[model samples]
Target chain A: MRSGAAVLVEALRQEKVDLLFAYPGGSVIPIFDALYDAPDIKLILPRHEQGGGHMADGYARACGRVGVVIATSGPGATNLVTALATANFDSVPLVAITGQVKTKLIGNDAFQEADITGITRPVTKHNFLVRNVDELGHCLTAAFHIARTGRPGPVLVDIPVDVSMAKTDVPLPTEVHLAGYRPHVEGNLRQIRIAAEAINQAQRPVIYAGGGIIISGASDLLRQLAEKSNCPVTTTLMGLGCFPGRSPLSLGMLGMHGTFYANYAIMESDLVVALGARFDDRITGDVTKFAPGARIIHVDIDPASISKNIKVDIPVVGDARLVLEKLVELVHFVERRDWLARIEGWKKKHPLTYSSGGLRPQYVIEQLDEAAPDDAIICTEVGQNQMWTAQYYKFKIPRTFVSSGGLGTMGYGLPAAIGAQLACPGRRVIDVAGDGSIQMNIQELATAVQNKLPVVVCILNNGHLGMVRQWQQLFYKSRYSGTILEGNPDFVKLAEAYGALGRRVTEAKDVRGALDEALASGRTYVLDFVVEPEENVFPMVPAGEAIDRMIGGMT
Target chain B: MTESKQVISAVVENRPGVLAHISGLFASRGYNIDSLAVGETENPLYSRITVVARGDEAILEQIRKQLAKVIDVIRVTELSGQNFVERDLMLIKVNAPAAKRGEILELAEVFEGKIVDIGVKHIMIEISGPEQKIEAFVELVRPYGIHELVRTGRVAMLRGVSGRPARAAESGEEKKSKN
Candidate 1:
């Protein structure tokens, strides 16, 4: 015999859940009491439920494991919605557990009841409401499975107060039997052959990889494919670390903020082999003009990704590793020496360059990379800083570069870095945020400082939302609309207010000084680098266009 | 986008509250179903549901993911290009009086359909097919009025492969025998 709360702990243990980020609440005291004795499960109490959710997502992304977050129902659950949506969009596997109102009080417009499940349905991968204590085991199992399955995302399990208080036998479910759910993990054979045929036959083939390659742990396979086929490779922002950026065959990154040579090669290639990448507007610029002459082979783990855009000649659906292994075995290696030489010449002619005289975002990223511990996790928020980090950071190891790629959500880095820090305590984690994006979730600093989470939030305080302003400057007739901050808080004062250390950097030479001081603080800290205004991420391909049409200072 | 209808099969837990979650999800998302069917699964612990609707690719993806997220929902599958067995049972009232009753009976016999009830004016008949045939049959029976009738929701499976449960069971049995 076990209490409902005890059963919940045991169920989580049975699922091999090792860590949990949580906040206590009125409706869920029983579960907290049960957690006191479960030393096997390490629980880190976060200052805010929103931070807990993000931390969970960061842990999941950093560790390549399921992240668990718990909160009392109502406000606790509501705070987690944005984090859940962020996780859902980025495909990070997170489990958000909330304590619900008592069963009888659930639909009676209970004080804390705001239809949490309804509010989160569109954003979360799935959600559950546990009515019976006996079904808690089943629900827990399904939540983990759903969270960590194909193209993993967040799942919410709303446990009512009574359900967590009632007693039951608490037998662990033997297995899950989901008739409608079967993830296609194995590669499609016909499509795989078609891909191999396309690769072997193409005259000027290039492999455009995405974050899926990194998520699938297919970096080695991707490199082998590129090396063996003598194909040039470029990656999306999220696709960093899938290939060695320093490699001779590497085209760096291809997108709005991609290298000019990379963009040019992708556009001019006769055959484009896109692996684990969605041709987002940022990457493709204008879809109609994207790789118009190239016969495309899109290989991804998700089926719906195939031919959804850019009508693929061959669409291989399966794990990139599994698919690439088969492709390597079937196809003979051939070198496109002429194509490679031509690309190298093009790169030598038009390289990714920035103004050498001014305080540059790229300079900040390069300096941070040099200052931080080797192979440290650099999480970035969306803006000019995010693009600059993507372009400049040299990530040698896998899972080192994390960001909001698919959703382009702002305020992602601070919480994500906190989560990443919790995931790998010994490793350094840094959140690179623009001044505008940082304020969105600046409250999370208290979450970090309260828990002594050694996460560094480096704020590129450019005064205006860098990315939005850049778009306005280029396309919006330079009429700034709600993009600039009126009374920006003294970031240094804000950090001190949150019980965290703070630093300010105003000079071009002080970037290294600010980064070093923040990292050395050995506590939750902020380094407000007051950067130059009117800076823009360059080598941009205008919307719905090809990479060849890149226009910027560098291009 | 030509709005071609789609058949989605969902497996959910067999419980009274499961329907609330599923129906609530569909309602909140403003997704309307053309026909929905729910029945107990081969495993008594669960139930299998099939839904039919018309939507484009993005909507189908949203629906599949949304269904998969429902707590009681065990699995979700959108039967797209995969070779799968699909069927729907529809009851139509044919205009069969004494004179044309023989012809209607012949047609029912050819299609293996049964005429459940008959009146002085109309005959109630049930027919099933792979959507296309069902549409053709309905068109042929259009000479008669379709009275209040219900169609079992679209149920589907991959064309030539074993389902996940069966495969898992076989693996489990293999391990058991080895032990």
Candidate 2:
């Protein structure tokens, strides 16, 4: 006979979980004790449950594995709400194991008792509440299976403390039999043929890719389909690295805050082949008028995502890689010189640019991209820093750029970088963060230092909530009410206090040097680049407006 | 795209949180649920949920797809376009004075409703029929004054030989055999 906690650990071993991000509490001490004897699974503790959750998200995105996070009940589980929503929105595979109050005390207002399963229902792909020790092993295995399969999202398994402590001799189930859950992986032949015919008959075709490309490991197939069809490609923010950013046929990103030429191309295209992309509001500003002239062919694994936002003429439901593989096989080469010339002209006329006088965030990101290794992974906090990195950095490979795209969670960077660093031990990981966003999870610095993970955090310290400030400047008549961040701590000293290296650069000339030193320091480092406060992300399509209509920096 | 009512039937694993999952999906997506009914199907491990919602074609398509995406939902079918039979059961307590007792009984007989209980001052009638029939009956009895009324929403099934088979049963049997 073995304790339920030991059985749980054995199940983790069965799942081949090498790294587990967790935080201990009163309800989880039994499991923590079991973890003490299990040497195969390395448990990394975070200061807060939220940080641990985001770390798991980043680890999943980086390694294409089911990221696991464990926390106690009540507050510990609630703290993971934001991270779970973030992962759900991005469709990152994550399994969250939370310790619940004892089964007897449940629903009786026991201490540290919360209905975690019910609370996380909408945010998670699936969830379970284990009522007994026999259900514990099955729930865990099923959680991982559901998290990693079929459009992949976070799954939560809430195990009561008594169940975790109860001894059970039942062997762990080797198979999952979820009768209601089965993902459709193969594309219909008729749909593929119809899509191929549409592509062949089109003159101006643009390929729009999203995070699904990375999730499906279809970047290569996507590139093949694009090249075979001679189609120009544009990606959403989450799809930054799915296509080589430096390729001639690449339109870096398309949508709000997208490249000027990319929006123009999308607006003017005769046909748009969307692969694994949901037409989110950010991508389809003024949905009624978005890509008005384009005949859209949307291919996604989720049937609901096909026509959720914008209507599609042809809908192909299947795995991204499988569909793209068939599409690559069926599509013939086509050359549209006129379409290519028009796009090139627009690209030359409206290249992404900013005023180069003061210390600019764009310039710092460019410098970092130049100094970083070819395979270095770059993560970003939300706001101006994320948009700038998406614009300036050239991502040549998939799984190299990690950011919170759908939920737009701030403070996701530092902890995500820690997870990425651990996921890819040899690759240099960097988190391009904003001054306002970094403070939300700055306490994660201790976790990174304690783990001795050499991850660099490049903070663009502009002393304001830069994205909101930009919106207020343009739309709200420059009434920057609460956007300004005041009395911020000296980040360099804070880093030193955590026993990590830190540097502050206030000049444009020193940006490159600071990045080089931080990258070479072989320690957890923070490079704070004091950037221009008023600088705004341009080529902006104001919310609820047409994608082609812009406010500033068109040229 | 004009808005029209559509009936959706979903077979799902019978569990504690399944109802919340289905209802929450509707609430979150801004889909209006006119009425909903759920009960155990032929298989004890599964439940069938019938939902009446108002939406256009696009909205209906989205509702069907989203429902199917729920992990516990085994299958979702839109019973609007097909020939289906829908029924709602209601229990209504109407004030029946000595003078109106005979009239109330006569009205219940016309509607094929059964008089479940007779109180000192009221008559409780159990009525099960299509929504329109039930509504008409309620309106006819409005003159007598209703004390209390409760409806079981709507439950629907396809008509004729085109009914939904015991697919849930087959799956359960498959699992049993596998074990």
Candidate 3:
């Protein structure tokens, strides 16, 4: 007899998934038992279901593969919602498996039964309900295929308890056919040729690369294009890891908090070739004034993404790796030294810097980075710490920077770090958090301590909703409405309360030492850096305005 | 006939102001909806809705975009090609209605469709192709009056993809409607 749980495990193994980040529950007891005996696929028990989901997301984004998460039905599956939404917005591929009470109990509102499929319908690319163990192979194959293809997003499979327990003769699917799921990977040669000519003739060309560069696993190709053509590159927040932060042509995150030089360069460039970057509102502050002089060429893997956000002069519909390779083949390297010098002048004249006021926030991240051991993965909670880490951290390789970009999910960092640490067992995972946002997923700290996962959580304790507060300061006249955060948990005691190491650092000198010691200690550590909450990230562009109108930078 | 576009924004309580209400409005009156997009706006307490419907050039400017201005609504913009932008989602299944199966499959292939389920009498095709293709395929398959049709109303991004990105520099509504 083929048990549902066994069948599911068999199917996952067939898909070549070696690991599952998950939390067990009453409904999924059978699957848990099956996992206990399974020798091939390792299961990581997340402290929280939300963390499980985020681990999947982080893994997917980090590895550029479909991340898998397993949870029990009802609340267990419900917690996966935020991560699924995060993946959907960011176009990350995740396969979430949730165990239901039983198929018969569906619609009856049985104990621990929630229509997770229905709940996740809009947010997920699609979902499935396994009625029998017999369908496990087909269902899993479809789940992985859907999760990993075309504008890749999250997919859910809700397996009933009975289905997981009931046995049947296994009939593994050797092949799966989805007539609807054909994703066009090869570049349309006509569009490619047209784009090549545009680039071949461009006087002042710029390559605006996005996360697709990393997703396509074509950083080498992107670097080749940039170096060969001497094309200056700008990236969205998602595209941060694509170009080396130290590269000469690299212009840092270009959007609401983007560099002044990056935005100005984009606006003034005669040619803009967008690779996988969605022209988000935060990036295109004032669309009317954005790249007005540019002849735009957009190359993307998703057909829907083509001209979905920005108007295209020449649209190349293909994967970035394939498309970039072809373009490099057809075109010769050409650089305007005069133009490169101009951009360098802008970069040199307007280099990014932060002042160490009464309390320096930038110092906190630096300290955390210094303290963190080599191969330590930093998962950043959204808001100021997230941006600061993105700007300041030296992420030398892929999967190193794991945080929410598309969704700007505030609670993602702590749980995502928990997830990443599970994947890379040897690496020290740190969650650089803002005190305000940390509260959202602070429950996971117990997970970290319980699982014996040594996560060095550095809380940049700025006592306000710092990002929004900055906006209100710059644009809304510092009315200081609801931005002030007060009467929060004593995090030091809180970490100790959870039986973990915790510390509060008020001075800059103490921060590095505290972090270094914490990282050196094997147990989960929480360092609450009492940074001056009033400091703001500079070069802020007011919404609905031109990017060039960035305020607050000395440059 | 002269045509004008209306932009109507609505703030609906997130509970159950679903299709039944929207359908009741359109079914009760013969108002054709050109485009509609609904999402949680700045505040999660309410959903912000923007619809661009075309018709009746002579109606009151306030009245045309006013249907959504009911108590549930907090804002409105009866947008058009000139002032506003709109996009809609369509999942269409044209005739594989018994007689011409293979030929219809070829057409469906051209439109990039999936045959979801097949019956002796009809085949249910799933397609997220262009609206023009949907309309054209529906008309092409119309010797067999369509059995069922459902479309998510249009969501608009003002001219360009991003709000502050350069405006689309104007194109035919039909051409711009390609997405």
| Model 3 per-residue lDDT tens digits across residues A1-555 | 778787778778877888888798988899889988987887877778887888788777766778899999999999899989998888888999999987787889899888787678657776777887888878788888877775688989899988888887868676676422445678889889988888888888888988888777878888888887888888887887678777998887788788778888888899998998878888888777889899999988765565544667798767888899898877777868888888898898887778865557787776666666545777888898888887677555555778888788888988888777767778888888999889988888877787788888888898899998987887799999998888989999999998899999898778778877888888899988888878888777878998888787654
Report DockQ per prediction, comma-separated: 0.14, 0.41, 0.03
Which digits, one per residue and each the tens of the lDDT, describe model 1 over residues A1-555? 787788878778877887898899987888898999999998887767877887888888898999999999899889898889888877788888899999899889888886787778768877888888998888888788877877778988898989988988868685675544456667878878887888888888989998878778889988888888888899888788879888999988888888888888887889998888877777887777888789998877666566655667777767777888898776667777788888999888888778875677778888997998766999988888888898888776778888887777787788888889888989889999988888777888887887798889888888998788988999999999988877999998999999998888887888888788888878888888888788888878777666687787654
Model 2 lDDT per residue over A1-555, tens place: 888899889888988998999999988999999999988999999999999999999999999999999999999999999999999999999999899999899999999889988899889999999888977788888888888887899999898888889998888887788877778878888999999999998999999999999999999999998899999999999999999988889999999999998998999999999998999999999999998899999989888798889999998888999888888999999989999999999989999998889999999988988999978999999999999999999998899999999999999998999999999989999999999999999999999999999999999999999999999998899999899999999999999999999999999999898999999988999998999988999879999898999768865
Candidate that would win on DockQ = 2
**Model 3, stretches more than 4 Å misplaced?**
A367-375, B1-179
Estimate, for each residue in B1-179, the C-alpha lDDT of model 2 and write its tens digit. Answer: 89999999988889898999899899988999899999998888889999999989899888888888888888787898899999999999999999999999999999999999998899999999999999999999999999999999999998886444666345652211000
User: What is the Cα-based lDDT of residue B121 in candidate 2?
Assistant: 95
DockQ of 3: 0.03
Tell me the TM-score of each prediction against the true structure.
Answer: 0.83, 0.98, 0.76
Ranking by lDDT: 2, 1, 3
Every candidate's CA RMSD: 5.7, 2.2, 14.1
Candidate 1's displacement at residue A65, Å, is 1.9
